[model samples]
Target: MKGKVLSLGAAALLAGGALLLTGTANQSNAQDLLGVSFIDNVKPYLEFRPRYEYVDQEKTGKKDANALTIRTKIGVNIGTVLGVQGLSATLEAIDVSALIDQYDPQRTKYETVKDPANTRITQAYLAYKYSNFVFIAGRKYVAIDDHRFIGTVNWRQMPQSLGVVAVAGKPIQGLDFLLAGVYERKGIVDSLNKDWKMDKMPIVLDVNYQVVPQALRLKGFAYLLTDIHNTYGIKASGKIGLGNGVTVSYLGEYAKQTDPYQKDNVATKPDIDTDYYRLKVGASAMGFFGNVMYTYFGNAGGKDAGFSTPLATLHKFDGWADVMLSGAAKGFYYGMKEWCISAGYKNPVIGKLMIAYLKFDSDKDPGFGKSIGSEVDLLYAKKLTKRLSFLAKAAYYNADNGYCISECNNKEDALGKNDVTKYWLQLDYKY
Candidate 1:
């Protein structure tokens, strides 16, 4: 988790042909472009997203952050390469421009807004298919399941990607598997400090089987992050139909983390062992859906260790306000427990609207109070056209009376001690 950041932004290349390729290249013409036999299919895509974000933190004394940013992504997907039937390639570039940069991209004077002004090659990958297996290499988005353990942080203006060599396959009718070795991870921080390189490439393995087509599915995964920790887990999820247009869904997952394979002979190596659990139940009918969930992250026996998902999309879990994000990375002294309730409605004309409430507590009592915090989040998204969309989101966090501060054994727990509120309005256009 601690390593040099790969600076891919140094040589920012803008592919001007992306615009032209998206418009005029048909199959007949693409097949014989520039005397090449197998440019068989060329599809170019572009996305422009302009967003405004406001953040207000009560205890942080610094000025509130107002970040207005725009994200542009342009890419081309080549279905066939050099007349090879199963060979394909994808190239993408992303740029984030800030109009109002009043937040901390790299520990600035203002509050923290993860959006930074920079450009990088977001995705560049080559894939080849043979039989039931597909081999992938280069840099691209690497996500597993729900993105809880390993994922692309797609919520931010600058998403996360991995430099990896991977193989994926569906060898049977109801089974799927992926094995990847990740050498570099590009996070959503500033481009200069975004990519993380480790002494050894992390290994990820995932296997899933549909026990019953749409009724039950089982999954097993192991993630070995060098110098961090190895996490292995099992998950079972399923959906059931009760009546006409009504369905219920459920999920249960459990994981354990242990010390990873380490070779950086430091004075003192890390000691980590923890447990994690997540349980959820949900139901949906007639354009309405609701869910109740419980999640637990073990403390790794407190002090300087804990279970954390270094490669996860942290923003999607814990709380929308990120009240538990930083602290969760180091593991709390008393561990952390979260209870969440969410409801949403979707309509073709009215779009989709959702609201979520989350409560955080400690697994064990500290001298102060077990109460951690609570958060409320609201979101509305609508598609304006075939290739355009609008989204609005807000989160409010109210801190509790757990003031152990610097004098406490676990200062990292104070990451959520300050009350914070944030709002975002965004527009996305894609072609």
Candidate 2:
């Protein structure tokens, strides 16, 4: 099915390119091909990333996993759409291939890496800009602030893209807004896995205002995932200057999740009434930084579910091990709370070095203990050249009392609570 869909898309794009060439044969402009003008300008880009990942689980009774993958993207940016002044378009495709495929893409037998070999059109969008507003239509990457709700999960070899029609603009000073209607979700996984859930369309609205130039900012957002769920939230952040080249930053956010408004009354969905909260404080001075954060996902037990950010870049928050990614849904049934602290340094020559520690626990104990686990994450990133970079990162998780309930008597690893360690080495290049 995905192959058929991709073929149709490729054919359409080829047809469009042919039409552009035909139009250029009849028109004339400054920049010409074979003494004939070809629209305005064409800019092409290429990117390549090769990564090696290793995963080890303490007590899964399965062998350790190793994966080597390469991701490549090729795209072109058209300046003007067939001589239209404010119209432009971009089209791109991506491919991911595996050399050592020992890990499972899905978390079944071996350790999961989730980087499967695949190829698809990653981005294809048309944009029209007038004044301060831009209108966009097509398949593209749509990311919200902080990526707490909706984002392009770039951590995966196959980033998530959306099919949307959106309008973004700034009508007043220090204020910006985006309104979009989403029809398709091309997630990091394959289409056969139900990753492209187009059953009911979703609507999104995001507004941000700068209350003070560099001191305070406010944001409000709404996401209505029809037949699934709905989320509404507000966030406030600020930065304070503290004397000699030092600054302190803080953030506070709160949100509510509830049952969504179904497009059709075919089948009733699970009831949901939960809350989400995040608080953070950080300080930076002389290329050194430190931060402390706490996040909460409320518990709605029984037949109801808790707050879950299904569209968010889940790997960024909670922990790098991604144990809490589904803990708030049904894996834990009691939701989760996390406390984290991190410190880092950055330099032009030394690049960036960061380390973080996180402690996780359930909001309410369900028979067993509330102790979920703790994790330590380390990262180092360096730019080797203007268009090349290197990165090394690792995560180690220690399950304090294991993540098991009364159901699993002696098999504590049944809930995937075994000690896990993962590391990666990668190089990225772009032209």
Candidate 3:
């Protein structure tokens, strides 16, 4: 699911560029642009990561079967620092497809979404930056350092999240602070068939202090999640650094949600209160880093004390094999608890190879009721040169019980779980 194209976004950038180059570029306060006289400044960026893979899906589901997949993205930046410091903007578009093989005449969205499905966007935005603060008003990426609790959701073929107006400050040499208000910004057009369930406004605050100069760092998060039907009290995270390229982090999140229109089936109970927390630790040094993490979510989002991170980040922590990306959230193994331990090895000459084993267990019931599963993944990533790179990946997921999500969780459709085994090769370039 990787490739690149300008789509119609370039047109808008060019139009905006003409406004800047002709109208504002001549401003006496502005700097020369490439020795070329212009109205506005224009810069383009391209991100392409295409993959070829073999996939096997459980035959129990008609739509779940073996196939191949491809992904791509393109972006442009227009506007200038001439008239005003905050007078600039950016544009981005992406395309995704899947099929039995390149030889197949038809392609699917994300190369995985069954039925004739695809996704497109005009992620455009304008922003102005001055001092330590910036204001963005468009569908741009919103990500923090580790992305454990909040992220831009960039790992998927159609990565999505929200737009935000954020302010940051550096009062001291080693300290930094941030405050932001998030707005619902996912591509709204593609989700019209169903009532697009979205949050109202989520507040995020973070602060980082450099304790031992560059040798150690500490960070804290207090995310206030609230919507019309639910309110997540607050979420927290702490990161610490130990000398010698080693770092550790922890998470303490709690929340509650109550919605009668929260599920597919009409027969579900409302969660008066669902509170849970997790204690996770991770380390990476030189050529090795592994993480042992766990989570406990209660009827927080729906299924009475279930473990799913609505505001939490499911992208950064997982093995990247995608076994737990979607369906993992719809399963019941979360009622009790879940954990994973993963590690990696780096070979400077070739690339970095990683392996991980993830297991989800539930005690609410057994044998076809609520169950546990295991997944194994091995992958390698390498940059062939400054602008080109490649990745090779393989994985296996064994669901020793009923459909991973159907029996254990209600949000099954979003997460496809039919015991899958897959392999893929991807090529990427930067421009």
Count of clashing residue pairs in every prediction: 0, 0, 23
Give every collision pair in model 1.
Answer: none
Query: Against the hidden reference, what TM-scores do the models get?
Result: 0.89, 0.88, 0.72
lDDT of 3 by residue, 1-431 (tens): 32223443444455345443455534433346434333356667766655565556674423433444445565667666445645677777766655444221243322243212254554666777777666666566666665555565565555655666677778778788777766654632244122222343556677777776544566665555443133333444555778787776555545443442233323453443444556667777887878777765443333443434444345455444455554333323335455777788776677898887776655455344455467788889988899998888887887655333333434243233457776767787888
True-structure RMSD, every candidate: 5.1, 4.5, 6.2
User: Alpha carbon lDDT of residue 299, candidate 3?
Assistant: 31
CA lDDT for candidate 2:
0.78
Instruction: Report the Cα lDDT for residue 406, model 2.
Output: 17
lDDT of 2 by residue, 101-195 (tens): 88886334677787888878888899999999999998999899888888888998889888888999999999999998887778888751222
Steric clash pairs (candidate 2): none
lDDT of 1 by residue, 153-205 (tens): 89999999999899999999999999998777778874423333545677899
C-alpha lDDT of residue 416 in model 3? 35
Best by lDDT: 1
Candidate lDDT values, in order: 0.80, 0.78, 0.55
On TM-score, who's better, 1 or 2?
1
